[model samples]
Target: MVQLLNSYISLVIERVTMTDEQLVKECVSGSQSAQKKFYDLFAKKMMGVCLRYTNNYEEAQDVLQDGFIKVFNKLPDFESKGSLEGWVRRIMVNTALDAYRKAKKYQKDVDVDSVGFMLDSKDFIVESINADDLLKIIRAIPEGYRVVFNMFAIEGYSHKEIAEQLGVTESTSKSQYSRAKKMLRKILIEKNFVEESERGH
Candidate 1:
């Protein structure tokens, strides 16, 4: 009986929290209350999302604000066929990409025909690192590598897409992502955050 009552309470709480679709409908209708609630729901997550693509706090804040502006302006065109969160996420990503392009951050020319190199497999051992520590290490990566890494590894963009977006060759995108992974692994190893093979076992 106690377990059943607990489950019932959980369902009640879930029902009280508005779905993303419900929020979108309200936002599109220009409901101030809904807008406030939507901001409260996604602001922090969107900030973190922006931070991953930017070099510093100020740039991140700018991206976040700009992304939100785009979201509000484009909300009416959103088709409800898919996840509203996903639609908003794409906008945030494109906003970040636009910021990077406008900043002219990609300056290196890469030889696409160059041989592809492999990263050390040991880096995958970093499964033990906490989310916060992982984020810190990722943030420490240089801007070029950081952007590619976040897009490829976290945001699920392809090398071709990354290359096109950053105005670099596909080889450059792949190389930067590999370098980012190697650097992150090195940082984790130096911090003694990840156990050596024997210790990990």
Candidate 2:
């Protein structure tokens, strides 16, 4: 899978614009050219989504290739409940979660109370960190925190959905998410993103 996706990445190809329905129809018809074009059109943005759910670039690429394969197989089944990109992203996120579940060791034994250091005030302006920078930071967090945080905070999945998906209790999901937020705040402060009041008072 990795080799296949790597080869796809190495090709110097430009993506062409096509209507979603037309592209989907061509891809579903098993047109190699259309499939390659579909991959080009969505891979970059979808890879970013994959990165947020994985720890590193290689794993992100793994999830990306896996997700794209699913998208191709499932294209004909899509009911257009939402935008094509959004549907693709939903699949990518679920595929990343599957990758996480396979690891089966994301449960952390950390002391969330001690680990939760501080909070960032509104003036902290975390927007200074762009998407890639933020993904790197989030990926550095513990696995449980990363999963819960990405699902609840970024993807806007409810605690119930997260608990069900991750095979944990809702409270566990909520606590891990809270801890993730606190940890993020601590990191941002250390990077000098704290408000003036947080600096000394």
Candidate 3:
């Protein structure tokens, strides 16, 4: 009877859907249950964002936890100027970038222009690949390439904006993005996702 009563209460709690504003208010009001619910709400999606920026699941998990901490701490300041999810996503991305910068792996700069990459988006039909496959390919690339690619291609940030964020020149951002595309196409071809002829040579 005790176990059944606990399950019933859990179900009732799960069924109680609060608006973002309501949840934020509760969280700000120092409610542990509300805070847990808020974390549960955005954790998965934010984890995906963190994963795109990190090398592996473990690193991503760290970023996710850090990001959520920031989110909850800053929740009182969130003025509902945008969707809560969008706000959370921005925090996750920034947190991932912070982790990247702290790791100092981005110190090695590759002269991507020397590789003579064709700077065109018409090269690969990325839509042919599923999200999981694409994510795997993204993660397989070098960290610098991965960061530039995620910022420029996936996140819709312009090269100039990406350069500002990553503390590199615009040319470097462009070169890295081009190199990322070339690497992605090469990987796709190697994986048989695209035909040899369609390798965008």
Candidate 4:
């Protein structure tokens, strides 16, 4: 993947206007220029998704490279029933999940009950924090909590979906998400992004 990206990076390819379908058709037909164009189109936005799941930028880049490789290899299977970008984003997310599973031994899971830390009925009003700061705060969370948090909260996956994807119980997913929110709330208060009093108990 690294070598593939390096070759793309070395090329001084000229940009051309092509719709997603057109790009995919050319790419599937083995156009090197078209492949580079496809890579350039979605790499930045997908990198943001990758960053949300990874511990640091380098790991995110690695995920991004691997994701693109999968995207190309699986391009023939794309049905075009959805937007191409959406399809690519799913590949990137799933690629990240694969990385998370491979590193599972380093993470510890807490079999938290459904009753643990019910922040669902409460409200939090975070103030004046930019996207970068928020992303940093999320990246600081422990691996188990962070992955579950991103999948459930940000990606809009249900606890059942998360549990199935991560090979855990639905309750485990819920508990991890609750803990992630609790930790995030604590960071917001400590960093003065939200006042402790503003949070509902």
Best by lDDT: 3
Worst 10 residues of 3 by lDDT: 111-120
lDDT of 4: 0.81
| Residue pairs in candidate 4 whose N, alpha carbon or C atoms collide under 3 angstroms | none
Candidate 3: where is the Cα deviation over 4 Å? 1-17, 105-108, 111-128
Residue-level lDDT of model 1, residues 1-201, one tens digit each, is 999999999997875786777788889899998898888778888888888888888998999899999999998888788977778888898999899888866746333223222335455446677766767788886777788988998788999999988878999898788767666655666787753442221
lDDT of each: 0.78, 0.80, 0.82, 0.81
Candidate 4 deviant stretches above 4 angstroms: 1-17, 106-127
Clashing pairs in 3: none
Candidate 1 residues lying further than 4 Å off, grouped into runs, are: 1-17, 107-128, 196-201
TM-score of each: 0.79, 0.83, 0.82, 0.81
lDDT of 4 by residue, 1-201 (tens): 999987776663423446688789899999998998888889989999999999889999999999999999999988788999989998999999999889765344554343222334233334476778878988877888989888987787999999889988888787778888877777776787766776645
Pairs that clash in candidate 1? none
* Reference-based lDDT, residue 48, model 3: 83
lDDT score, residue 71, model 2? 95
- Supply candidate 4's per-residue lDDT for 163: 87
